[model samples]
Target: MSVEIALTPQNPTHAGLSGRLVCFPHAGGAAERFHDWISGFAPVLDVRAVTLPGRGRLMDQSPVESWPDLIESIVTRLQPLADRPFAIFGHSFGARLAYEVTRALADDEQAPNLLIVAGPAPQMAQRDRKISGLPRPAFLAEIEAINGTPPEVLANTDLMDRMLPALRADFALLETYEADRASKHSPLPCPILAVGSDNDPQVPFHSILGWRHRTRSRFECRLFAGDHFFPFTNPDFADTLFDYVDDALNEHTKDLHRAG
Candidate 1:
């Protein structure tokens, strides 16, 4: 089944930038959420956030239940964009999905310039440990505890009623994900920049550092002072991200010249 993916560029003109930064949203997020971020990364990096089905413009569409199905759908839609120098930035559940998509691209001999994973560890953890399957009240409590769910959304019962199902569905997808250990044998040939929040309970510093084991390329981890959704709270998070990207780009260019 073809999942109707809504791909919208935040800065289309900036798509011609030196490199592309494909931004994948966190769970229960929409591409439009990052519209302002594109401008923050302009001139050097173009940002395009993926709008998955069952959310945003594709809200009416049914969300895919399995990881393989979701990854396949995303790769199909994003393959064309692979022609240019690109990197990926995914948060929370999106981070793992981004890694899977990168692996898919690498298998097809289309590796990106860099991989940025935020708010999640590199490898998949046990599905039985998922807390998203709790009852509605329990789940809402969990969301509240995490502090990622906006106050407006939580206060508005009507909006919460509408969004809760999709949020649960997304949680189910993340909870049930099973990692393919075989793919780790040949990790993508690209640098990995793991970003973790200082207080993100879901992603620990140790787990983020584990990403080093999966890459032959340079691996670096940065800790930001915030919760699970650091970027949302800290206005300067985007600037920090771009700084790392700028450094990576310079090193890559230098390496190319040296090789030449």
Candidate 2:
């Protein structure tokens, strides 16, 4: 279950943009994670990075539960932007949400043209066993073990205290998320582009292949250099996304031309 995250798009340009690319952040991540990086992908794709409550721009706000409510709220806020062709991109924890949201909109006008699931594959995706409910020390350790959380953030007590709620909320969202019967058996019609890093423990090369089962249409997998957070560490990671987006759009255009 993709939790109910109350992230309204902050970028006004999304309303009039041609096609939307809704990017969901990893666990404990803020919308800014992909927002600033996708400046180059603008115009062609209106990339809207989801800003959940209690982190990033919404740090002052209380975090909502990562359950049905979060997913419902995300759908409600993102519905209007589905006027044109769109893609759903999620990294690590965000990947599940993207898939779930796509399933939620299976019959609607908001159905995504493609799903770019980055980082962990569904079988071994980023969901810890109830770290959200763990004690402060244990929770922090788990986050650190994931290797995605920076050392500076862990070192800074003030920052950790402030961001702890959002982190825990996101963890809980993934933790309690059980694959429903429909999502388990029913594969999405849209194509899926699964991406991961070869060296990343969270996303083993073979594990990424499991995404093939989740899609009824096309499935493509690409591995990059670096760890799970390659997007942040390697600038080339952004290029990969752009390339995939361009390829998908081109294929879609060909399909449309043939149809006409």
Candidate 3:
């Protein structure tokens, strides 16, 4: 028997731009967390952040357990947005999910123009598991150390109680993901832009370099000055990302002119 997967659809907000950039959040992240960055991408790219189940507005829904299931759901939901010049930007767990989703789309002969894998290594070995097996206090301490969890969320016990389950569920997904050798490191036709932080403990420098083998298209890697979640801490990270996007688009234009 075949299982049907249901994905929560978010209405795309009008951005008055021709291109679309679909962003996936990190583990335990909500769609709203990316609104500011989306706004920044609005001048040149129509930014739409995926709202996955069991978080934010979809808090009541159960989180999907398996990676294949999650990727299938996302690919189905995102098919409509593939018509225009589109790109994907995913961080950490979201980066892995984005890579899987991109592969699935490519299998169907639908691939994005650009893929930005930020804050995560491509291979499973490089990924770390710190939060999955931790006790409650230890988990909270880990969150605190990351500095990504908001102050209000940390201060309010009730809010933390409500959010913890979803966070844990996401962590479970990351911890349990088994790498498929058959699907490992297939070369993509589109250019890939890798973003990493100098201080990110979860992703090693060599692991980030492994991404080069996954794509035959042009590849660029940039190391920003900050920790694991550099975009959150550094004010200039968004500007740097935008600059890369602009350069990629320009290069695409040049390629088109040459082909014409």
Candidate 4:
């Protein structure tokens, strides 16, 4: 698949950016999830949001069910753009995918400068209750419990109907991800930043801190005030996010200069 189809550029016309920020959305979320985030980093970075199969413009296509296939497709499509200094940012389920993608690109000449994951930790042991296989009603209830879905979407039955298939598929992917299998690999060389909420029921504070184990380089975890979807819900999220990303990008540029 072409990278054009796999990514939706948020600031295509912006020029002279030194780095790129590739964003991956939460489960069942489309590229639009990062639409509001474009303005923050557009001046310094080329921002592109991932468009997974079975959602948004690719709604007609079959959702990728295999983890390895999904990762391979993303990595393959991203290779062309990976030539530049870039950062990978993902939320919730997307965070897990970002980690795997970073691992796959670890040896590339222009590997990601940083990896930013939000809303979930590297540990999957906490999710003991598998809701992906539950019937429709039960599945929706569990999704609601996560508090990631907006109230407007939950209230609209027709929209909910259209969204269920992708939701179910994504949840199944999350449920099947084996943490033990992932941990066997060497830790990433790039720095990692984990963002999470203090009151998030689905992912606790300790869980957010657990990401420190996944990186050989620097690891920092930032805690905000909100529920699981604090990335979108918290008022201070945008400023805080941009500040961290700016520092990382600056450091990456300095490293490239030293290497040259």
Candidate 5:
């Protein structure tokens, strides 16, 4: 409902830094997923993670089912933080959020300096069929097959039950988002760094490379070794992520100097 409930700083002590990295998690993920990243970029970037409803600290609230409403909420929350140089990093479902949020912010003439999208294309990632409306068992099976959920969690009925609401809502959001694919929107003005993995089953190399077309500014794609969850499992992920953030910020500085 408010920015305070949505955006959480991983390292609040490092707030007011010249740059910020706002992170969005995949479906069924909590902001804590980015906790480890704070240590790697805190010295230079104020890392903040988004906590959507029906999960994490917002567990008491119902998950947002509308894609437009979710994007509007995120863009509104991000507005105050965009006062300083900032970048947005999102994975899977969050990648879509980051792109839409960036587009909305850019419309307000307050775009981020960089947009880092991982695990999906700038547009909706292709899906075999709509699973959100499937029967409970079938839906869970489909989610398990996607490999986003851990095997142990799938085995634990209690955990799965607790996670179902948010998971269902998020999947529904994706189902509805498919309708927007044919809609026309302009490319973003800021640079974009699209990260993917060599062996990601959900997102192919071309899907990651697709982000290049979403930006009018610079675009780069980096492939690593792992699956869709590479950002959490890959050892070299932090280094590569921070490196791009640094480069983007440096480039922004150079542009500012030229304009001054």
Candidate 6:
């Protein structure tokens, strides 16, 4: 499957101002999901929401099945715009994907300044039940139980038809993923911000704490007031994320000035 994502805001050239933030979407999510939040990043930051194939305009294309291939595809396509300082953010499955992409960029001199992950955390706990192969009714029930999918989409047959394939492919990607054993290896160089919810039905507390072990630089966590979907559902997500980036970038500026 030849899959390439044309990130929104295309070139992302920063004009030597602030860094750009590249956002990856959750399972069955498209890049357009972050459209409303781009303005929040404003002049100080450039934001690019990656649109994976197999949804929206690319509905006819086959979704990439292998995680490595998918990561490489994203990294290859993103290399052009990575000229200046930048960061990467993702939610749930996208979070892990973002991390892997960061790893792929490891050999490069100019890596992401920070990483922000929401919804799912890295985990040691194993899932007792698998949601991937469940019957149609059961599958929808599981997705709904976790509050990851909207009820309106479930109610619409046409929408469900378009959504299920991509959802299943994303689930399979997660199933095949081999989580990084932070203790066994060196942590990533950039700081990480792990965002979660007190009541996220899908991702547990261990998931949040796992991020601490994965970062060699700095690590921060923010817990919001909703469930698994809080990253996108909460009205204040843009403000919260923006403030964190602002603070991080500001400190980065100071560090650069000090070194100079």
lDDT by residue for model 2 over 1-260, one digit each (tens)?
43344443435654555456788888778776775655777656677788788888778888876556676778877787676677888987788777778877775646788999875555455454667888999999989997757677789999899999988887776766664443365778899998888678867777778889888999999878888777667779887787777667667767777999
On TM-score, who's better, 2 or 4? 4
Which structure is stronger by TM-score: 1 or 5? 5
How many Å off is the CA of 60 in candidate 5?
1.8
lDDT of 3 by residue, 1-260 (tens): 12233332333554345567788878767778687876666567767787677777777777666777777778887888887667888887778778888988888888888999975455544325557568889998877776546666788897787778767776777666655452376798888888888887767677777677778898888888887677667788888877777666666667767999
Assess the local accuracy of residue 190 in candidate 3 as a C-alpha lDDT between 0 and 100. Answer: 82
Pairs clashing within candidate 6? none
Question: In terms of TM-score, how similar is model 2 to the real structure?
Answer: 0.87
Cα-lDDT of candidate 6? 0.75
Candidate 4 Cα RMSD after full superposition onto the native fold (Å): 2.1
Cα lDDT tens digits for candidate 1, 129-245? 566778889999877876656676789897787677668877787767655463356766888998887887767788778777667888888888888788767777888888877
Scored by Cα lDDT, where does model 3 land? 0.73
- On lDDT, the leading prediction is 5
- Give the local distance difference test score of model 5: 0.81
lDDT of 5 by residue, 139-184 (tens): 9989988887767668989878877888888888777776346235
Query: Could you tell me the TM-score of candidate 4?
Result: 0.92
TM-score of each: 0.88, 0.87, 0.84, 0.92, 0.91, 0.89
- Choose 2 or 3, whichever is better by lDDT: 2
lDDT for residue 78 in candidate 3, whole number 0-100: 83
Which pairs clash (backbone N, Cα, C closer than 3 Å) in model 3? none
For candidate 1, give the lDDT of residue 223.
Answer: 86
Candidate 5 to truth, TM:
0.91
Which model is ahead, 1 or 2, in terms of lDDT? Answer: 1
